[model samples]
Target: MKEYKISLPICENDIDTLQAGDYVYLTGTVYTARDAAHLRMYEAAGRGEDLPFDIKGSVIYYLGPSPAREGQVIGSAGPTTSGRMDKYTPTLLDMGLKAMIGKGRRSPEVIESMKKNGAVYFAAVGGAGALLSKCIKSAEVIAYDDLGTEAIRKLYVEDLPVITVIDREGNNLYDSV
Candidate 1:
């Protein structure tokens, strides 16, 4: 597998260079959203309303971090199970979402949409929340404050590690294992 360091707002060119199982360290803006946030965005789109943030070229992490301790930028910022968002993923992909960071296999429909939309999927190691939080340099809730930890947060990450579990060409690392 190859290793790459990528910046956020990844474009089609960046997606083209990635392959399943590649190691990547992402440094840039990443939005955190869990299933609750996804559902809100999906509903907003259906109503022809604007999403809270620009969806184009965005990388979303399916995370809902806990309350931070004193002096911390964020709490345990781990990825949640991805399957719960399967029903809403295809729509987001078509809306210009570039990549997603989460754990677990995605549904076949989500995989197909990724191929059609030229998106990538990254997997963060689960149960490594404490370590991952160190990569987040800043965090601010940008929407859905009522959801508390599940609120959509704009995070600036530095060298956050992830594995390319599914590439734009539809290669799936899970299938290889």
Candidate 2:
């Protein structure tokens, strides 16, 4: 495995450089959305409506952060189970999403879409919300506030840790294990 430090708004050129099992420390803006937010975005796509955020070169974290404690930018922000978003992921990839940060495995179709679109899948350490939250510099709800913690949020991070679980070539870390 290898390690890399990447900046967000990650592009096709960035995607081309990663391989499964490589460690990544991401710095910049990334968005957070869980199942509910994803479904809303997918439905918006179906309606030919614009999404809340631009799709191209964006990295999304599958998370529903808890309320922040006093004087904190965010709460225990960590990865959610990725499979929960599996049904909607490929569509986002097809729409130009460049990378995803979450925990666990993705479905075959999602992997295929990642390859076809030159996207990447990453795994943040599960159960490490507090540690992960330290990397996040700011957080704001961008959509679906009624969903509370499940609302879509834009986060600015510096050196957020992750491991590439699936590369653009369809290589899967779980398959190797």
TM-score of each: 0.99, 0.98
Q: Candidate 1, clashing residue pairs?
A: none
Best candidate (score: TM-score): 1
Please state the error at residue 33 of candidate 2 in Å. Answer: 0.5
The clash count of every prediction, one per candidate, is 0, 0
RMSD of 2: 0.7
Superposition error at 111 for model 2 (Å)? 0.5
Best by lDDT: 1
TM-score of predicted model 2? 0.98
> In candidate 1, which residue ranges exceed 4 Å CA deviation?
none
Q: What lDDT is obtained when candidate 2 is compared to the true structure?
A: 0.93
